[model samples]
Target chain A: MEKHRSAPTLDDVAKMADVSTATVSRCLNSPDRVVEATRKRVLTAIETLGYTPNFAARVMAVKRSFTIGAIIPTMENAIFARGLQSFQEELHQRGYTLLVSSSAYKPEIEEEQIRTLIARGADGLLLIGHDRDPKIYDFLSQRKIPALVAWSYLPDSKLPSIGFDNRAAMFDLASHVIGLGHTQIGVISGLVDGNDRARLRVQGIRDAVSSSGLEAGNLTLVETSYEIENGAKAFRDLMNADPPPTAILCGNDVLAAGALRQAQEMGLDVPGHVSITGFDDIELARIVSPALTTVHVPHREMGRKAALQLVEMVENQTAGTGEQLSTRIVNRPSLGKPALG
Target chain B: MEKHRSAPTLDDVAKMADVSTATVSRCLNSPDRVVEATRKRVLTAIETLGYTPNFAARVMAVKRSFTIGAIIPTMENAIFARGLQSFQEELHQRGYTLLVSSSAYKPEIEEEQIRTLIARGADGLLLIGHDRDPKIYDFLSQRKIPALVAWSYLPDSKLPSIGFDNRAAMFDLASHVIGLGHTQIGVISGLVDGNDRARLRVQGIRDAVSSSGLEAGNLTLVETSYEIENGAKAFRDLMNADPPPTAILCGNDVLAAGALRQAQEMGLDVPGHVSITGFDDIELARIVSPALTTVHVPHREMGRKAALQLVEMVENQTAGTGEQLSTRIVNRPSLGKPALG
Candidate 1:
């Protein structure tokens, strides 16, 4: 609220220091151009008066800030760590400082954070997904701001997205499960409410199942938040059904891990009693016992590309068209032939 | 370099708009305060000239930005996630935005980021660990900036630290392992270079062994980076010795999980063949097969405290001393009594 108050101007400092407004401006912007005596007098006047410069006025004058803002859904997992690390490295190489804020998977929070980043003079922005209120897009367009969406690619969307094809990728992984003769499949998906990637991935699996002449309702689905504990609990609830699924397909590795851990605790033999699979081959996938069978997302590649694209859009005023990366299923011990009736 | 050179200023916009400097500043900072007719003139001039405000100059003038910057060692793992999430949530409750950056365990990078945050006019800062160049302390002090350190508590440190006692906490866990009658111990530690917490933890284990009348030299120590794969490799090397120790102590859960996984791969029974223990009872500790015995660090609690303390310092203009938090060993299946000779 105090920051919103009218800031002291160069004219005020000049009047208090008994100097011309031009001298005050030179002292603040380029002290080397002004004599030390005048600069000292100006600074003393500034300190005594508690003067603060108006950022909006200054940004209107300066065309650059060397600041990049990135908005991620959540930071509680290592899912985006590798890619974000590479993105930050590239930004550092270009002498740009990165400012990151998490949205906790809330659309309203993401919108607020976007406005805050813009207000803070971020030259460019890296968004997680292509799903949000279109008004945000309009705001960015009206401001002529550069933004690149990562995590999921949306070719038909108006914004340029730098990510993998969530639908096609998940479809490929699901087809693989179907190829393995997994007819009685169960899915543990992330809550799809504002998450386009999660929703698309779930639809991809459904498309694969329906194309195979399987009744869509036969595939039991459990939607939950993204956490290992939540995944485990969801798995337990899904497993307690009247006729439990013979194969489980999780939205991501985090959930698959929970399912696997729960299965172990429940004394069920993995891949024998029921096969399990996951998306996003994070570190936990390999570390978990009976290493998870999941899709290997190119997080680092996406991160690097997103940074470059956003920076290009910011610097060259070039509009971006969404680019799709690749994803593949990594066969591990978690998935196997289900037991015969 | 281009960003540094092509920065816009208030003077450029005023000259283009054909208005006094006061008018341009008023138009941008408070358009409602200015007449609508003159505001449109300034807006058109801004668009034609492609102007952006200078953040640094504004920060120097406003003294309040409602932005808090946090610098952590790394984001490669979930060690800092839970706590940071809580910290960010608390700040959000009070209508402040959190800007986070990672230093990758580099002191120079941390120092640069601290200066950058200050120059960007962060209202406060959350830093990890108390070790740093004293000149950074002098800089923050001269600028009257508020900062709080987390992860490890130093009672006599000049800066305010909100964390647990690393040495004493590890000492307690080590004593628990000693009580389990494991005299032959192998230690897997994080690289102590520039890491006071890791060094103190290792020392704490050594002290525990010595106090138990066991030869400290018998405690084989292997230092590695904080990665699961690295932990596995270190475990193998430690186990390959002619007489492997009966128990293995890891600096953190990541390393402990690695040791456990490697033990499983080697067909060595955990607890029966070799007992293993880890610090930082992260989710991985529980997720790993045969839940790990580790020190239960209150990460969320520390995060909340760090945020509150930093904000307090920022508002009150007084740095507080270390406030110690408690830690205890979580007894899990990873550790067991030593096998009989």
Candidate 2:
């Protein structure tokens, strides 16, 4: 520990390799410009001295850090894990490092993280969802920072996104549920205050309700944070109505798993006493008993494409085009015909 | 976009605010050194110009980034999510930013990420486990960077950690299983090659089998990556044995959930035809049918403590003390006595 009191500088490497500092710098920045034998000597000296090329100096010289930052809602569940993994893997293949930070579903925290990432020299950013303060877009624009949004697609939004339409996907799922000979329906939705996905999903169900010539007032709606326990509580509240709805649709799989558990605790058989559905075919969707019927968004495709497009935008300074992905409903045991009267 | 083609420099802020470059620099770096009236003018100019202070220059001048980097094995599941969320929350309250990267359970990736984080000027690091190449520890030591380990505790390790003992926790759970009058046991474990936690857990079960006077050969073990499908496959492999083990102990709840699902598919009644158990009672444990008998870890506590200790090490330049957190066995319907022969 005493021997390595100070980090060896570029000068130390130059001295060790018996070369000028210019030669060391050239070898590091443009290896092809230097002869192989001379570059080898400099590299060997660098390794022996354990000298790390100064990242700060390099960033200043090249005006690019080759680091991309991603800000997600929460890391408390597996919802964003799979997609983020694919995104990171894709970025790594492209020679970019990914730095991730979770905002815990708070707009203020997300805003702060955006600034933090920028302050930390991120060349580009991957933001989740298109719903945020417009000033944030102005901030990024003023700084010429390229940011790409994922998870929810809004074609005409100020930002470019590679994602699926939450509203239309849920509309399709709701239409299927309504077609299954069920008139009464309930919804367990995530808080819609800041989440466009949850709000659009609820609207989709409402659209299905009205399209089927049913009274919109008859649909029971409960909004809560996305959690298993919250799902169970919302399920209870929906069931306690004078006449419980025949089917319940959850905003995501985590909430659906909770609803399933609460139904078991209540001794009510799923799809027998009530049918339940969820969006996002995460592993939790299938692991639950009766296996959740869900809307399968192409998570990996969105992640991989988002990475590819964001990197291109960063490198080429283009206002990248937004591409909309499609989703399909997964039919499973959790959804069935309402019990015979 | 054409008007703002180039970024506004410090000179631009100085000219706009009618202050010298030194005053503008002082206002940005140490506001107390400047007058409030002048500081406000400079700040307003900065906001109008959207001048982001160069992070690289600041890091070089101050020799600190106030950013902590954490590398986890995988973000593909909820195993580490809960704890990481807590860790990030705590770091936020301390005025420090957290940058995270996932290794996808690959050691080489973890090693590369360590270098990346250091190069990008992380003031400190939070590593998931103590197991890694010894040279990596030497590298960190040579750079004089403080790194704290979390998730798995090893008291004698070179690095300090705030985590629970995987071996003791699993041994307690295994002992409880053996006491339930089970003579034959099956273990579904995560691959132990690069993971100390997985290796320790398998060893704990082996110790429990021997302590109970059962032939070690009777305790069948199948190792696979941590995934639900792998767990199901491993379960099938274990059950194919002649006179299959009466009980199956999964490394974690995710695996246990898969095994339980497969058992249902195979038409085997849990705790009736064969008892099953799990470890690390994540939310999935209770969400599964029959619930899961598993070990409950203090995930949030460990995360919060890890943050507090790591921050102290970074801020005060102290060698932080390691802490061992305790875990308990949570009895659920999944584990029971072997059916009478």
Candidate 3:
């Protein structure tokens, strides 16, 4: 087809078919409502002129796009891959298309993406964390857009959230390491600013340290982005300390994997010289050498539940509620008795 | 605001603002085209009534959405993550929003997603690989949507592609292995049925074998999905052969990481017992134990270039051209001399 000087409009199609614009709209949106002969005529005109129904106008007329938008933190790691995969699959099963945007862990970018999705007539939105500015919630409320928060669950949250308690899960993992006769400890955590999950995980480690009859301040804590190279640098800094902690608790499996790799490269025997533990029993946990001792969050279940609950809220126009899932510790060879100094 | 009985349409906004429907549309679409006082009254009404502009109608009116859609095979791994991240950044710089859909490597799903994105008014599309039904191309052509293929560049391709030659890259890696005295080689590749990248890579290895005075038939090939677990399973099956190859080459780093993990589990030393090489120098290549000898793909460069080229095609309405980058073998400790039998 030759390039059109301008796109075919409803008026052009209406003029060609000798029908009103309303008739064209009805033929496109509700074909069964129109007469068969009129519908055929309109369809023929639309084909001849290549008239596509305007997405925004259709959404405005019908008040539905059957599209759900999700804004995630980062796609650079497999941490959220499996869960988000399940979330979209469930959405598809319920006859909804999903639009995903990655924010690269930047809150400002996420806000822009959220606004962009809303402007695209997204039926509802899925946000990764509940730590954004309250103004965003106000905007969503004013726009009457239903949003579901995933990856971090807060029972008293103003928004509906479906996830495991990050603090409690990390606490359990840290306590298990404590029970394994590890006295000194080090922690490598994700950046905590505006991240409730990271902050809560760090708090969990502190609670575990205090409960184990050690000063929380005694633990060496290093904060870094969720990357393998960053995790390696953090691990090295923690190891070069005057007296290194016998056990290192990583914020997630990716960080823990990084620490394990660093340990291997430095000729250190894991669980023999320095024990390393992780949270989030993603595939990375099992793939790393010696495996990883981690807290297993039910990623698939969380994703599926988020999708079902968000769809229910959008379709039924009901207030969403938080559903807290449980995480269990998966003991692997990565953590064991600390070696004598 | 209380929940509305029905969505506020353009007519509702016009009636509330005491203006005509055309005036309301003009105010929303082109505020500069409207006077300040009139724009103010329309904006207030829109806020009070929560009126959303129709997406489809706007596209038909302006013929521009400033939105680009990409359909990638999978996001379960970091293989496409870095490249796509760069692409989005470049698009953002060009004042465009990116909408991404994962096809899960299914052609039907990809086609459906393509239609959905197009219906949503994507100004252009970025698709991975060149293997898709010709009908999809015809559909895009009919719609006059500018489409770009990436991750597999062909000099004489009908579609514009920005990527390195997958086959040539793999062939060079294979020839390098042959030069290292690795006569017996095993292949663990991504499923090549509808993936030109994977098929071309396998062919590249065959080319190297024949050119090096070795029988291409002697290279044991096992095809599976681009998954770590699948790679491990394929590695084990290949090792169970009458006499296993001393060198194993994987289509991507994810597969090679799996092979290395399996080798460690099977009590085989990497590069010492058997050399394993991989394509795609993703982070997994370096993070894996012993590191991976893999071909370094210019992920960020390809992503940036694809964005620049696709935007040029969409805005200029120009027939796009393919740009091929080069790949280099990153020598880590994964490959070594074959043991003397």
Winning model by TM-score: 2
Give candidate 2 misplaced runs (Cα > 4 Å).
A1-46, A60-62, B1-53, B56-63
Question: What's the ranking of the predictions by lDDT, best on top?
Answer: 2, 3, 1
Q: Tell me the deviation in Å of residue B92 in model 2.
A: 1.3
Measured against the true structure, the TM-scores of the candidates, in listed sequence, are 0.84, 0.90, 0.86
Compute the lDDT of residue B120 as modeled in candidate 2.
Answer: 76
| Residue lDDT tens for model 3, A1-341 | 87848778778888899998777766764455789999899989987886665565456445666678888888888888889899988887776778888888888678767766876778899998789888788889977799999989998887999998998888888888888888789999999998999999999999988988987656999999998888888999999886889999999888998999999889999989999998888888887888998999898999999999999999899889879999899999999998765
Candidate 3, after superposition: displacement of residue B301 in Å? 0.6
lDDT of 1 by residue, B1-341 (tens): 34544645667777777887677755554355678878788878866775644444334434456678999888888888889999988877665778898888888778757766765668888888877888778777766788888998988886789898899988888888988888788999998988888999998998898888888767999999998999999999999876888999999999998999999999999999999998988888889988999999999898888877877776677776658999998999989999997
Question: How do the residues B1-341 of candidate 2 rate in per-residue lDDT, one tens digit apiece?
Answer: 45736778777888999988777766654466678999999989988988776665455445566678999998888998889888988887776778899998888779778877887778899998777998899999988899999989988999998988898888888888899888889999999998888899999999888888989878999999999999889989999998798999999988899999999999999989888888888998988887999999888988889889998998799999989999999999999999988
Clashing pairs in 3: A54-B56, A54-B57, A55-B56, A56-B54, A56-B55, A56-B56, A57-B54
CA deviation > 4 Å runs, candidate 1: A1-62, B1-63
lDDT over C-alpha atoms for residue A76 of model 1: 90
User: Who is ahead in DockQ, 1 or 2?
Assistant: 2
Each model's backbone clash number: 16, 0, 7
Model 3 chain A scores worst on lDDT over the 10 consecutive residues at A53-62
In candidate 1, residue B296 scores what lDDT?
94
lDDT of each: 0.82, 0.87, 0.86
Task: After the best TM-score superposition of candidate 2, give how far the Cα of residue A145 lies from its true spot, in angstroms.
Answer: 1.3
